[model samples]
Target chain A: MKKIVVSLLLSLSLLGLGNAWAVDSLNISLAPEQANPPSPQMGDWLKFHSVIENSGSQAAHGVVAWISLVQVDPGHEQPVDLEDWSAHKAVTQAILQPGQQVKVEWPMRLIQAGAYRVVISAVDRETGHVMTSPFVDFQVRRKPVVDSGRILPVALGVPMLVLGMMAWRRYRRRTGV
Target chain B: MNPITLIARKEAGELLMSGRGLAWLLALSVIMSVLSLLLVSNTELSLLDNAQVVYMVMGTVTALGALLAVVLGSDAVAGERERGSLMPLLLAPVTPSQIVFGKMGGQVAGWVVMYLLSLPYVWAVGSSGQNLTQAVAYLALFGTPVVLGFGFLGIALSARLRSVRSALLTSLITLMLLASPLLLGPSLRQSAIGKLFDAVNPFSAAVNSFDSVVIDSQPLAMQINRLAISLVWLVLTAVFAIRSVRKMEI
Candidate 1:
């Protein structure tokens, strides 16, 4: 019984040490509430935006950030194309000093109409300390659109030509062309 | 007096006496010089900038050169006939071809002088770029043919036509046609049925040459097609002008 108690105490102490050693180096949060989200029109894609803060005493570097997205019920997580969003995992070079925060905008696309929940994560360079953003929810809808301004320039040009012709003819009659 | 020398000397002397040509020369020099200064300052005297500077010089000089060509060409035979000097020139012992060639030479001489007058200003603009030397080389060598081409059309038109006023207006129209690519390149190239406009247009060819030499770092080889087309037009107009002069009974 004494040996078993000693073994249990050792394992508990190790677990406590492990939890204590983990640093709180970074924090991330959505900066603004997107009240009225714009529909991802044609050629538009999905995007996630947030503010990342290095709350620790030292400046943070080698930051690898991610945006994980999932559908509501019966959820499935999918990887994002940084190129499509023009944001990447390698903001590692940025050194944000203590109390300094950087705004990150991530773009994404929805191929189908649905509800989505997005979560952002920021990992520190050396410590590997992680910070997670609040989950932001959005809805994507499908609709049809028609463009009518295609012929506007040409349509306006004809009337301008007619007015110019009338003025030119009047000038010719006066000047004897 | 021989037809060519007399007409050349007489026309040259008149141009020298007229303050109008000098005024244009002064304007051209000022304009080209200022353009060179602006470009040279931006280019920091790079060789490419130098070429652009030379091109700017060429552009300004050519404009002035074309203007002089048009004025001389429009005035050539028509102005003479309008002022009652055509009869004396026609009545001379020289044949009509000799008279035509002589008048053409005089007009060409005036244009050459006008082009020469812009050289100092051109050099100033091109001082920063590699094209300064190349431009000067081309100006002294290839520029004459261009002058001949533009001058030929104007002079030939004057020889065939009897009204200087009409010739002047037509020369302006021709200059606009020659430069249409500058004004109409995008509209004609972008709109519906743009393909036909690009294919048939000679002005596009000239603008292409300008782009190659001025904007792109290409040599005169790229402009050979434009040069050839211009030469063909020159030859056809010359033939027509000579025929018209030969056909003139008076």
Candidate 2:
């Protein structure tokens, strides 16, 4: 019974050590890069800075951080795909040592007008633990970049003009006008 | 005027000034008008970036230009043969190479008209975005070779194939194959085989160049390799068209 108890204790300690080794100890904080960011408008470019720090005793290997934007507008609440907003969505840090902090900047263009929440998420590749920063809230004012009213006239006018010309030409050819 | 220019003028006149030509132009304008209206008025599409809309418009224009080229070129030889007009042209003083060049000139004229017609829509869609001028410039620079290459492909097929229907069918299928990359999902286009096909496809090169220049705001210097691929396609198709016309049995 004494030998069995010792073996069980040893196995439990080994498992605890392994769990501790794989535990994620990363913290991330995200904020606008500018000290006082202006009110964002449609078509405006903005940048956000995310700081990832390792708060554990061991190094965190293969840390990847990405920025995500979610439209929080009442009727249109959904995560925005970063494909059109930003080209560089994610940044990778090969190894983050204990007490080491890595800063990443994401440049995104505001393509739509709405209320949005931006969050930075980081994952430790080895531990598969995901850590997300607190949300940064912002509102984009509407700036009419494309005037549909102006486009409507040209869109509808050009074709009408071409059709008129075609009809006139056909009439002239047929009637010898 | 030289025989080449005379022939080219005649071909272009027949294609551009005829009732059919006017009808095609009217159709193109209507399509552009509808596309622009939908893009600007639709809530979801309007929310897209202006540059993205411009890129889409440019892509559609290029495809339309290529389709017109293929249609015109397919009819260049086979339609004439069907109408019993090929014998006189073949017996003329002009060489087969000259005739091919003349037909290519006519296709270029059609593409020019198409490009001009697309500008207003491009401007209307992208006026509020970045790289508007660059997008227009790249469309002309890259679009010409792509359209011409497809035109030559059509002419080559028409010269070799005895029937206009077969020539048009083959040319359109070839165009579909070249444009297959555009139909692929983003992830699939990044695969090795997809990359290889895109690298060689003049159509993809034109579309990718438009994406890079218009949407991503990439500089022209970065697009040399893609431009080279388009030029290579133009040269290859031109050679093929000439050879086919020369060897065609009247």
lDDT of each residue in B59-148, candidate 2, tens digit only: 888888888899988998998999999999988888888898898888888898889889888888888767889988999999999998
Give fnat for candidates 1, 2 and onward, in order. Answer: 0.00, 0.58
Q: How well does candidate 1 reproduce the true complex, by DockQ?
A: 0.02
Q: Candidate 1, A128: how far from true, in Å?
A: 26
Residue A109 local lDDT, model 2: 83
lDDT of 2 by residue, A58-162 (tens): 898888888889999999999998877898899889999999999888898887889999999888866745788989999988776687766887788888877
- Compute the lDDT of residue B59 as modeled in candidate 1: 53
**TM-score, model 1 to reference:** 0.52
TM-scores of the candidates are: 0.52, 0.81
- For candidate 1, write residues A1-177 as lDDT tens digits: 999999999999997765443355677886434543565432235555687877777777767777776667445445433332233443443577888888887665343345667788777666645777888876666422111131233233333443454565557768998
TM-score of chain B of each: 0.81, 0.95
lDDT of 2 at B220: 86
Model 1, residue pairs in steric clash? A45-A108, A46-A107, A46-A108, A46-A109, A47-A107, A47-A108, A48-A106, A62-A92, A63-A92, B50-B129
Worst 10 residues of 2 chain B by lDDT: B39-48
